[model samples]
Target chain A: MKDPMIDIRNLSVTFNRGRKPVKAVNGVSLSVNSGEVVALLGESGSGKSVTMRSLLRLHPKGTSIEGSMRVAGNDVTELSARELADYRGATVSMVFQEPRLALDPVYTLGQQIEEAIMRHENVSRREAALRALGLFEKVRIPSPERRLMNYPHEMSGGMLQRSMIAMAIACNPKVLLADEPTTALDATVQIQILLLIRELQKEYGLSVIFVTHDIGVAAEVADRIAVMYAGRIVEEGKVADVIQNPKHPYTRGLLGARVELAHGRDRLITIPGAPPDLAALPPGCAFAPRCAEAAAQCITDVPRLTAIDDTASVACVRYA
Target chain B: MINLVGEPSPILPVGERGGPAQPLISVRGLLKHFPVKGSGFLKPKKVVHAVDGVDFDILKGETLGVVGESGCGKSTTARLLMQLITPDRGEILFDGESAGETLPLSEYRRQVQMVFQDSYASLNPRLTIEESIAFAPRVHGVPAAKAIARAHDLLHRVGLEPVRFAGRYPHELSGGQRQRVNIARALALEPRLVILDEAVSALDKSVEAQVLNLLLDLKRDFGLTYLFISHDLNVVRFMCERVMVMYLGKVAEIGERDAIFEKTRHPYSSALLASMPKMNPGERTLEPPLSGDPPNPIDPPAGCRFHTRCSFAEDVCRQTLPPLSRISGAQSAACLMAMTNSGHSRAPVQMEA
Candidate 1:
């Protein structure tokens, strides 16, 4: 098989290392092959965003990261400051949730896209501007020329997100990191954006690590889904298998809780308790307190991500 | 405007006291327009038609879900029902009396409470959870001690133990907990109708489910009516008995949940339903149901508000506004195609095929 475009091994990231540290991501290992889409599904504070940000090394200065992250054949953890700057946006790019906040308010989208291109590539200003227009057209933004001159705020939320996607793929990165890109968009516009991302990913053969809390969206776009609970990946499998036959209690609860258009269930099955506090997580399984299938052993021993079948792996004492 | 001294009082009898079986709240021809600031003093100021010619009825003890994209005036309609903003035109009839005419604004507001999307912003940081919930009742002339006791009961009802959480400030709670507190506060007034404006949108799926179940239980126990406004179609479908779909400050469709979801007639409603990302990976959306955003509210299309992005737009659709017409039992849509069956068939059948 071809080498994985992005390989993360035993990745652990903690904030405020010495005093009152928060282990945001604990022992997460993920691999994304070229042209594949892996979704990291979790609620707030489940370390889905933190795990993705580690790929770009975008965490705050005090964050202590202990992990092996190799993206596009480069050790992300060992990159120097100069190399790191070059790595971002060129090797790996990200599309954030709120494009209005991510984009520069003062600059026209054209200048920003041109800047991104000129910063990384040895292209003239005019050539970069031309490329930016082409990128806009590629993303199917209407009137690409006029849209290029428009400021971010002038465009609607969906349009701004499309421009953001256009900017993210300007450098033709190998791996794309999208953190809830469609969460802020309206429903009709959200489908357009999701389809655009999927189309661009296939066109470029980019490995995508899409992070979202919506299982429906993950199912729509992801090839594989990794369910995270309290900073740990409790389940990882092909989207169909995970949705059809979920092994982990948390995954099952999430599926049951999902409000589907087809199903008219009276009450959604809720996971009893909130996610554990990362700073003071419970020993053993982080989800044990909320897991209905949790046993006495679940409280005392951490469950490793063991392969349940050729297509799936689950980190649960029940599975063990 | 002369009044006779012997005229009977304008106030209608309260809550099914010998009155006909009328909806609890009825809105007709509601319109709210805000003037935009022009570049210069001489430039003709444009107007943003935030809520333009919207009409609906909310029966007592029924949950009516309003689903629409942002800027579709769903929030504006909610605020209008709460009487937080005055309408430019149209009347709001509450309990068989025109609100602000026979019925006073204060009484209208008392009967209709609102819970906003941002729980943190809606709550006071300095106030404890109990104090926040108790504030409304206390101001409405309930005794302090009784209000406090009621707040404690409400907190317990929302699954946050009053003994542990009552004394804690808003900042001390998580997003879901803060939202529960917000819900409790909305219920403090014993309102007949509660406007939930994206209340669960900010919560996680698990917590959202818990809150939705709690809301259902509260609705049943208290006999409360709800105006559930959200962009999440699934949640709206699950929580609402009846649903209203809006497009650019106008009612696109309104009907029973099953009628709206299963046999939708409006092109816009069908497109919106088709746009929902499917849970099955094997079934992908073949095409984007609708392209581009809704047209700017300031300069909405002359005919159908949705024609700009609608795939079934015909020449007539761009020239003449379509009045909402009933398609089947309790299901109504304001689409030229659905009304006449002339252009393309409704968006759902076309998309499915």
Candidate 2:
């Protein structure tokens, strides 16, 4: 509890390309202690996924990352190719949005999972196979033994996601990074997956960084939420505190526009315009264009994230 | 033929042709079964029961929401209504006139339009926003100049300024903008019944709210009825006046939005409602309301398709397929417990109470 398991400090990632580089992650600093789950909430182009992907050092060549990213006591940016390979699945694992694309179609699910296990540790094929079945049962895959032989195409979306979860925890990873795991599934099935992830996170006492765009989902899963807007963290707080009394104007707009919250109202109180383009975002606050409370200062000077209390922070001129 | 009364009071099936309270579109025993591949040559032909024995009434000037899992045939039902696919059996009556028989197919089609989920694929890349909207109207005997004029008018109505967006191609616009253009195109023919199949499911939170409000305005101004299909329960509840819950191509429950959302009768409906993420962090869902994926639709469970997953399912539920019958004032459910005499051991006792 003294030090966070995953600490990202003053990180800035830029895509090195034509003319000006695309600044994807700008001065993002977040920390997750052991067994704590923090949801990085943002709409598209907000760079939530990019920040999570940085922990694994998965960015393409020519991309430059500044500042420190420490996961499981290892400096992620300084890790070599061989060290990164060993650190990835054993120390931290990821559950991607689309399991169909994340999983290999050519091999059986059993083969893929067993291969990952054996690569991480010195285990025999038979032992790895047994461990795979155990992981499958933990994730509640029906008829685990038979399902192990089925290809990725044979399973439903929810089933495939369960298999993905099973594979993710195959190595007993310390941290699990889930990027929109339940976005594609049906509502009935989505709840099941969310519950399973929560249950697994508890049983394993794993630190988690869940990236999602849906606020309801963030509330349901994460202990803390970091709201991102145009490559910047606009607000960070406990899920209840942020939801009950949102500090930032953008977070307030998000909660107000939720259809469930607008139950009795005839017309939804929508934020006027769309999210700003990340590549060519204007100066000052990116959300100032659509923010109802954007003052004259909000249009000229960018607001820094200022802490309001022990568990809450907001990045707006009014709060700053 | 618009119903001036916005309230969706249950208009029971009009047994005769010229009943006073005729529904805009009435579907009876709608069935469509797609055969599984490589099932031939002396083998028993396997069929995926995409839609079977479904019946509903889309009331005039009201949004009827259809919700289900991916393979529950919600989209199949919409396609059947649009004549995009031919059904194996059943009949669809438009204003008491048998569709394609008394009422010409083209005339029936002209009054109905559909907006799909993928905003980009629905429109052509080469055509500008004005041309895409004008194409549909031009196809139905409208002159070139008049169709283009109508298109510009529709773009303005859908909140896209014609002066700025009329000439832009589909690729040049954002996802929200493309969806607005698609909505404009759907309204170009002045469609009376618009089927929105996950239309706002792709947009962001703020954009979805804006589009939903726009949809309400259009519906009120045009006096249009909507058959809205979606997987998101929250969005469905907000947009729809009446809601229908389908499970494996069968109507588990259908009723007024309040009754379905509040006084839910079917086990499946309750499970679905419970699964919606409560927007508050204080009251987080402890247990998953339902577990396991939907059973294979190719060979659905015997009798009641939902019995395998239903918590209160009994032997009788496994043996007998319960009929969808009205239980409350405006709510109907196709569950053994809801059927007063459905011999599910607990039905009669509950019914008496």
Candidate 3:
């Protein structure tokens, strides 16, 4: 295989919360290829967002990140403050969950878009404005020419989201990091936004790290899926391989838990217990208590991702 | 025509005691428009048509699921049903009486409960779960001890250990547990109609299922009526007997859950259904997701609001608004193509613009 666009090796992000440190992400290694969309699928506290944020060194001040985190050819972990600043939006643009919050309240939508463009490129205000409007047009923002001057609050949630996407793609970044980009949007809008992102990805040949709690959204856009559980990727494989024939018990539980539109479908199957607390993670498998198929070995040892088939890898003693 | 007034209350099945002869809640031509300043004083115009002409029946003891894309007015409709916001036009008949005239909306409030989407904000941080649950009953004249005992029973019914959770504040409980308290509080009044607006949308999948199952069993044992509103079609399918699909402040399609799911007639409904991710791999249809965002509800298209994005849109669709024409068996859709044998059929009106 050709060299991946982004490579993450043994990356760990630990948070110093007073007395003891909390490992939000632990020894996670993942990669994204050119033009591929990789999804981080897990529940709210799964550390997917932390891992993705670590790519750009976007974590809070107290969070300590270590190991090789590279995007394109640059070692993201080794970047100086000034170098990282230049590379931030230019190399990797992030689209957050809430568009309104992501956007500046004071600046007009047009000004924000221009700021994004001009951040990575030295251009006159006029040229940046034209480029911003053009990017807005690509994002399917209606009447991009006129709506550019509108405030973030003036725009509808859908339009604001599109504007965020427009801003993210402004620098022509090699990779896009979307942290639950559509979670706050409605279902139809969510679908439209995901489709828009997919189109932009194809058009730009950008590697995308789409983080979401929704497996459905992951299935829609991701070429590959990584099922994260308590700061680890327990299963990683092609979207079809993982979704169709899930090897991990956690993955199966997630699949079973999804309610389907089909009538007379059995009551949704639930994995017992809540997601583990990141601060006090269990000795072995974090999901063992909730895993219906958990074995005696699951508690004794932490399973590493082993190849189940040609295209699939799962971290489960049962699979091993 | 079934006179919704005389028809069995959508919340209650026929032959059940205390079940309304008509739907527990009958919303007819409900329209909610929020006035907004558009540009200037002379032309201070524009109405955000939040819930535009929505009509649905919530049967007693049955779950009526409302599914819509965001800003489609599912939440707005729930608010209107709760009478949290008064309708600009149309009538909300609760238990066969005009909600505004027959009883003080507050009295009806006891009989009509609501579970909000956000569990954290739903409960008062300062108040314990016991207090939150008892707040309504006490105001409605139930004695404190009686209300507390009742709240405890309700909590137990919702599967939360009442003794442990009773004294805990909303912040102390997990997302799922707080939601259970919300459910328990909503059921405290034994309301004939309970409107759960995206009640479990924020929950993890397992937690969502647990809550959904709890709701199902609650409906069975308590003979409770539910207006389960959500953006998720799968959850809607699991909980509801009948489903109503809304788009841009209008009811796109309403039908029995099976009929709507299996044979979706409306193009918008089809598009929404097509976009949902299916768990069964065998059922996957390799269609690239829906293309465009819904047209602005404020300036909804001349004829059908959805025609702009509808694959089967015809000349008549652009020219004349489609009526909620009956299809088969208690199902109807506001789509010209779904109403007609063919889009090419010559009619009094042409579908093309």
Candidate 4:
């Protein structure tokens, strides 16, 4: 394959809190080909969101990142503060979980998108506004001309989200990192947003790293799926392969736990146990405590990602 | 002008013989519209149709699931049933009797209780689980010792370790454990009907299952009736014997769990079912989502409120409001097409194909 659009190798993120340190992302390596959508799938506190956020260096000031993290062929760790500023919203853009909060409350939707374009691209205010309007139309925000004048609160949640997407794509970035962009949206609106994202990804040849806790969403949109658990990716494969024939116990549990509306009247299955505290992670595999198939070795040595098949990798002793 | 009521009355009906077979709560045409006044001095008044024209019956010892998106008025309906808000129109009957007026609802209050969505802030941080659970009973004049004993029994019923959790404050418990305490507290008054408003929505998947299972078990053991309101379709399908789909503050569809899931007649209901994210990648076909949010509730569409988003809408759909009509033996929907299909052939065949 032509050099992957984004490559992350052995990426680790640690947050220091007084004497205690939280390893939020542990040795995660991911790659996304041009125009492909990769999903970071896991439940809350599973470190999926943190792993993707670390790609942008969006974590708090206390965070310390290690390993080779490159996006669009640029070494992210080597970028100076000034370069990092230009990199964000220019080379790689993000769509946050809550669009209402992500947007400036005082500014109109059009103004925000225009601001994003002008900040990254040296353009006149008129040109930026025109570009913002064009982006809004591309994202299917109806009556883009009128909506441009509406404040974040004036527009509905779905419209605001589309506006956010419009801003993200205004720079024509190579990589789009969406962190649970549709989590706060209703189901019907979520469908529209996902479709829009997929369309934009193909149209712009953009590599998308979509993060979400909902496995169903990942199944729908992801070309490749990475199942994270307790700061590490336990399984990675094509969405079809990983969802249908998942190798890791955590992935299986997650799939089984979803209540398929199509499964009319079947008893719902669910996993047991809350996620482990990041500050006090277990010594062995992070999911070992919750894994139904965990063996003696699982509680001692942490499992590394091993090839389960040509298309899949599983970090589990059973698969190994 | 509306009459200022003495107090908000419980929706539970009165005078019906308490029995295992009779439904615990029945609501009809429940409406609660808040007047929206503009910020300016000369602002015109508008009504926010928060909960408009809702009706459902919760059977004794059965869970009735209410599913809808945000702003669909599911929570508002729950609050109305609990008599936390006075309805602008309609009647609520508990058991066999109308819970007459606001003041008279005091007698009906003990029979109904509610569990809110946020378990974190629902319980008093300063009060221990024992005290939280005992608050209701003690206020109703139950002896202190008796209420404490009852609270302990309720704690055990909700699967909480009485000794460990009894004296612990709300902040001391985990999310799941704290929710269990909330459930125990709601049951402290020995209510026959419990309204759970998004009770498990905020919980993680695993913890949600534990609480849901606990709810099912409690329903069986205590012979309780539940009006379970939630936005998660998965949770609703699992917990409810019958499901009610709401849209724009109206009942879109209602039927047995299997019936609604298998044969949803309403366009809005079908869109909602289609919009849900599927775990099976093979099932991820390009189904279109509903185009936009429901028309502003303040000025809902004239005919079918859903006509604005309905892909198969007809001319009549925009001009004439469809009434709740029978779709099949057990299913009911407010759709003109379903009602026009009087012949069995049209109804069944159209649904199948």
Candidate 5:
């Protein structure tokens, strides 16, 4: 196979390394080819968002990152300060969960998109504005011309999200990183945003990494899913296989715990205990304490992610 | 038509619990209109009809799910039921007694408690887990020692050990743990009805499952009723025996869980169900089930609040307010299309330009 559009190997990110370090992402390796969509699926503090944000090196100054990240064959972590600026939107762009926070409140939607375009390419203000308008239309925003003048607060949550998506793709980045883009929108609007992302990805042949805590949303959009727990990828495989026949205990627990899957059951089968704290995770497997199938080995040995078949891999004592 | 004024005879016979067939909580013509800003001088005052004419009944020991998008007044309805805010024009009957009239406000409040979405915000930061849970019971005249003991037991029931967690402040606990403590506090007063306003929405999926199960178990043990309000259709379906679908502060549909999910009668409810992201990849919806956000509630569409977005909306739907008509046993919908059985006859309205 050709080189993946976005590639990361042995990626690890730690915040506030001196006093009390938080290991946000640990030894996560993933790749997405052109036009492919890989969903980083996990609950809060599971490192899905952290790992995706690493592609653009968006962490604070004191944070330490140890990883090899490549997007469109450009080394991400190795990029110089000057090169990093260009690398951010030209090679990859991100859509944040809260558009209100991500967007500049004072700036109109058109201004933000135009600024994003102008930053990447040598273009006149007029040209950038035209590109921004085109992007608005492409993302299916109603009355693109009128919407461009509306400030971020003027637009609804769904509209702001679409504007965010429109900005992310303004430069036509090789890879799109959507970090729970639809989480803040309503259910009906969430579906619209999800379908819009999928449609835009296919239309532009863009490789996308969509991060979400929702299994249903992941199932709907992702071609492959990488399930994160604590700070590691516990399970990774095709959406259908991983969801239908999960190998990892955590993945199985997530599926079993889904309220949608609990339609006929009297009681939902829940994974006992809470997620391990990222600041001070437990020894051995992070999920062992909550796993019903945990054995003695799971408590003592940190299992490595091993391929169970051609399409799937699981990090568990059972698979290891 | 059901009388909106002084209590009429019970709609159904006394239920199995030997109570008058009257529901534990019956809401009628509930309306809350908040005056909008910038309406004093040149412009006529406009009122945001936050909870416009919403009516429903919560039978004893039953979970009545309220599902709608943000601004659809699900939270307002919960707030109204909790008496956090009084309705402008409507009546809430608790156990066949008018909430604030026949039933004293304090008495009604004692029997009804609310759990909000943000657990941390709802909890008092100054109080420990035990103190937070015990405070309510103490206010209700329970002895301090007994309330403390009850708090401990309640904490344990919610899967939080009192020995380790009782002394911890709200800030020290995890999101899920704080939520459990919130639930424990809600139950501390021994309330018969608990209104969970997006209670489990802020937790992780796994944690949400645990809390949901705990809620169900508590319901069975305490014979409690729940008004579960959430935007998550799946969680609502799982938790609620009867579901109410709201749109623009109005009841679009209300029915048994199966009727609402399997044999939906309202266009809005069907759209809501269809909008749920398919769990199966093969069955992924090609197009968005519905387009656009709900229209502003300040000046909702002339007749049916949902007519602007309803695919089957007609000229009549725009001018005539459709009453909630019985679709089947214990299932009803407020839609002209449903009443006329012409849901599939007309093509869906074209997407707004």
Candidate 6:
């Protein structure tokens, strides 16, 4: 399929900071082809962010990671410290949830963009500054020159996020990892940012992995949607198919919970319990406790992600 | 003076309460401005026009939604109603009596309670969930035992089993569970008006629905009024009977939920409605409904605050601020286009369009 831009196979991430070793991401397999936008959809503690962070190796020391991740031809897990540093922004870039906290307070937005450009390419300070201005223009930020000169706090939430996107794309990375980039902004500002990101992704032919908890956001941005449960991808398919016809019990419950203003919300179909703890996950399906149609097998054995068609899969016994 | 451009009617939809329902709270000319630091001596003193010239009435037993962007003064309005911050110029009337004079601020505050967005920061780490919920009632001289009983009853009503959860610390519960505790605490005072300022915004969609349903139930069971403030439009649409759309400290629109959502009059309200993410993938939004961030609230535009980003702006819009004028049965908009004879070329046609 023309070499997937970002490919991950049976990836698992474990955090050792606490007393117990928490397996945050357990055997997640995802791939995004060139110019494709795949959304990692999940609620809090679903390990969607943990899976995405593994792509950039953003986890801390003593965190154990297994399985293989390939992004723009560099083996992410096997990269040496020096190679990893060189490979980070130029090969793949990330946009975080809170741009205000993600950015350095003291440095002006211009300095940050310029630094990113200079780090990746052999460019002079003036060229980098010009490039930063170009990026601002590309992102449709008004008064680009003045805005670049403003510090992080000086800019509003939407403007700060636009600048963050500018920095993320300054290196012209093939893969873009946006981790709930619009979650903190207002709805109007969020749509503006989403359109900007989509436009930029198209112009650059960037393979993007967008992570968010909001289903509507996933529908708007993603070509393919992967529904994550406790540390595992329970369902994956074409965005429309997954959203319109969720197969797994967890996926169905999530879709059923989607209450729009247009629909008459009599009652939201809630998944009766919370996400399982990463440190103390039960045997079998992690979603078993909350799944309405959970069979006895769901509590006895973990279901594998079984493919239904070319682009559809569900990790449930019913689907199998 | 911020008077109505046209003769004011009951712009809001009639409350569910029949026969000339008394408003629980009436906030008139509410204004709160914070001074920007480091603007002394050399430069002109600049203040953020946070809650400038805001006016709205929360009718008894109804959920009046306050919706706007981050700096749009929805939160500020909530704080003003809760009496958490004093306004520079305004009068808050509780049941036709001026608070701090006839009604008394303490009594007014006792009838009103607030639940903030951050569930963790709002709760006391040292106290158990039951303690947190009972604190408000005990302070109001409800007696310790009665307050604790009330707390347990509220916890049960909010779907948290008191037997298992009452003794647990804030850290021991999930985010959804913690928020339930916050709700229980807000209700402990037996307040008439509860200001839920983004109370469910941080929650996951499934859990948010649960909380929303719970709020509706509590409102019905306790006969409480809610100032449901949120940036999320879908939740607001489902939860609120009437809505007030604010922009840069001004009421952009206020109306019945159906009228505002279906027959939107104000351009800003239309944009806000259009900004909600579509459920169907086939109908995903192609372009942003509104461009640019909500203009800097500090030193706001002289006339219309939203004129800079508004697509239908004209010189007249820049020259004079349009006050809220009733364009429909249940909707009022502060846009010249919606105000007939407001001097805008499209005002006459804009009313019917």
- lDDT (Cα, tens digit) per residue for candidate 1, span A1-320: 88899999999999996668999999999899989999999999999999999999999898899979999999999999999999999999999999999999999999999999999999999999999999999999999999999999899999999999999999989989999999998989999999998998888999999999988889889999999988889999999999888989988888878777225667777789898888998988898888777789999888999998876999987778
Write one digit per residue (lDDT tens) for candidate 3, span B135-241. 99998899999999999998888888888889999988899999999988998887777899989988988788888878887877777788888888877888888
lDDT of each: 0.90, 0.91, 0.83, 0.83, 0.89, 0.89
The DockQ-based CAPRI class assigned to model 5 is: high
* 3 or 6, greater by lDDT: 6
TM-score of chain B of each: 0.91, 0.92, 0.89, 0.89, 0.90, 0.92
Worst 10 residues of 4 chain B by lDDT: B341-350
For model 4 the TM-score comes to: 0.92
True contacts kept of each: 0.80, 0.77, 0.48, 0.58, 0.87, 0.76
| Candidate 5 CA-lDDT value | 0.89
Compute DockQ for each candidate against the true complex: 0.68, 0.77, 0.43, 0.48, 0.82, 0.68
- Please give the distance, in angstroms, between residue B33's alpha carbon in candidate 6 and its true position after superposition: 1.8
For residue B134, what is the lDDT in candidate 1?
95
Q: Which stretches of candidate 1 lie over 4 Å from their true place?
A: A17-19, A261-264, B1-20, B340-353
Off by over 4 Å in 5: B1-20, B340-353
Model 5 Cα displacement at A269 (Å)? 0.7
lDDT of 4 at A212: 85
- In candidate 3, chain A reaches a TM of 0.96
Could you arrange the candidates by DockQ from highest to lowest? 5, 2, 1, 6, 4, 3
- lDDT string for model 4 (B1-353, tens) is 77778678544433336565766777899999888667336776678788888877777767889987888888888888878888999988887677756427777888889999889889888898899999999999999999999999999888887888899998877888889999998988777888899898877776776687788778877777898888788778878888999888888888888888788888788888888887777777475668876567777778888888887787778887777776776788987768764332223334545
Residue A275, model 1, lDDT = 86
Q: Report the Cα lDDT for candidate 6.
A: 0.89
lDDT of 6 by residue, A108-205 (tens): 99999999888889999999999999999998888899999999988889999998999999998999999999999999999999988888989999
What digit string (tens of lDDT, one per residue) describes model 5 on residues B22-124? 6999899999989998995788889898998878899887999999999999999989899998789889988888888877988788889999999999999
Q: Can you write out model 6's per-residue Cα lDDT over B181-263, one digit (the tens) per residue?
A: 99999888777889999999999887887888788888888888899999888888888889999999999999999999899
For model 1, chain A alone compared with the true chain A gives a TM-score of: 0.97
Candidate 2 per-residue lDDT, tens place, A1-320, comes to 48799999988899988887899988899999999999999988888999999999889999999999999789999998999999999999999999999999999999999999999999999999999999999999999999999999999999999999999999999999999999999888888998899999999999999999999899899999999988889999999999899999999999888898778778898999898766787788989999888888888888999999999999998887
